[model samples]
Target: MSATLHRLDARHGRAPSLDPMVQLVAGDMNMVNAAILDRMQSQIPLIPELAGHLIAGGGKRMRPMLTLASARLLGYTGNRHYRLAAAVEFIHTATLLHDDVVDGSDLRRGKRTANLIWGNPASVLVGDFLFSRSFELMVEDGSLKVLKILSNASAVIAEGEVNQLTAARRVETSEERYLDIIGAKTAALFAAACRIAAVVAERPEAEEAALDAYGRNLGIAFQLVDDAIDYVSDAGTMGKDAGDDFREGKATLPVILAYARGGPEERVFWKAAMEGHRASDDDFAHAVGLIRSTRAIDDTLARARHYAQRAIDALGGFAAGQAKEAMIEAVEFAVARAY
Candidate 1:
């Protein structure tokens, strides 16, 4: 990674923001949004009504934006990306709807989760509807390669979810296993989203592979930061309550590291907490102190920086331009959110 691609600069006394990437893809996103709205409509009022509750809710739409930006980087002028980007978003939204239900979560993006409002069955079924709609969009695009990449990603995501479910509350879960989980559950779609842009633009295989690397590493960095935020941030700042992961006994990187580094007494406490034996606010505060004492959060952020740098370096072949700059900054913003 080059020094120039660092997440923070001394010249700018603030953290990086997603504004650049958001601005760069704004116009194209409007088209994608239109497609999403059109496809979300159904004869059964409940389908649209339930889907709209979460779809119209606050989300950065980062997955679709990556597709548009990747297309821009490749200088593709065709409109096929619009529907494809919409498909990418449908895949992501469907995952989110299903995830909230699986996690039994109450809040998302500072709002009540759809599962909480509409019930688990409704949320799960609507998620299925969105998944079907995404496949429809893919078929409409008429690219076997694109369909294969995304459909494979969808399958990998489902497998990752099941893998995480099995690992849940297991304090002994290894970091390597955790990475495999996130790589499939989170980074697979990210990789597919950017790779498909290359397919649509008729770019060479190398460029497709490069974009996949960029999105894959960025997705890992993004998830790392999100996991760190669970310990450092509040509901207002992070859109989900602080310590939710701790209460849920999620074996995120920080917890894994802290458990590895802790003394026997600390390890016992961690085991109890993960087993749902310690869940009070005081217990959570103690867990945070233990994680801090072990330097878990700092090291977690350091790991995030490592992957973010890799993501930046993955774009080395692309020419320096607005699209590349925005893509790089987006990677910066992914890790910077923890600060």
Candidate 2:
């Protein structure tokens, strides 16, 4: 294990939390929130109403926080990051709205999903509106480099969504393919969010690449832990029910690992489950049992720790200070959440 991972694993007494990062960016976040609220408005009442449902809902705003924190790390003192950070959040919120529609998810952040309450078409159209708004913010920023990064990220996220949709309900999906899906879907925006901060700060390309690496690795670790939590956390804790992925037949990392490591009978069960033949409460319980017995969750978490270490190491060029500490702690928090 890397020294950072060892230190993180040794912190059993006090679990890592995003509080430090949140506090670090609190002042900047207020301005970003203002920009978000102002830009999401529309002459059509339904647009803001639906958009606000999820935006006003209690998301941790992690992507925007990364933008602000990265700017802080580069010693940037300008107000440009506030608007760009809001743009990052708009992209993220738009994706969540679309994802809940695609996944047929009923709950998010422990509340009814926008699609469930307002219907799928409304949710989808509002998501489109948010996407347009994000582009407007990017255009207004007037930096082609920033625009390219975020625009490319938006396209990559859409491609990733389609890729994942095509790969859904296949128990034989390989770990490598799964990684590619998540790299585009989740990590693309993370890398763009952090990389754009360096752009606005007029930092060099090396710093931009470093921040991109940090965000990319952290995003992969974050999604891996989230996949693991689907089998371990309840709606109250994770804002979604335990076994939601299993019920939906989504081939997340845990399911992939368990299927790869199972015996003949276990493999049959997995194939049937992914084919939607077995979806009872008892079946989910059995799936969890097989996962535990196979040590899939443990090894999945191990993989997350590996990426989390890389994320921390990516910041090595930055000078040591509160921004660096909070960013490292944020990675720790991402990997620690499944515990």
TM-score of 2: 0.96
Candidate 2 lDDT tens digits, 224-329: 9999998884535777688888989989999999999999999999999998988999999999999999999999999999999989889888888889889998
Instruction: Give the per-residue lDDT digits (tens) of candidate 1, residues 25-117.
Output: 899999999999999999989889988888899888989999999999999999999999999999999999999998999999889998999
lDDT of each: 0.91, 0.91
Best by lDDT: 2
- Cα lDDT, model 1, residue 224: 90
Where does candidate 2 have its weakest 10-residue lDDT segment? 1-10
Clashes per candidate (backbone, < 3 Å): 0, 0
Query: Would you give me the overall lDDT of model 2?
Result: 0.91
What lDDT, from 0 to 1, does candidate 1 have? Answer: 0.91
For model 1, the run of ten residues with the poorest summed lDDT: 2-11
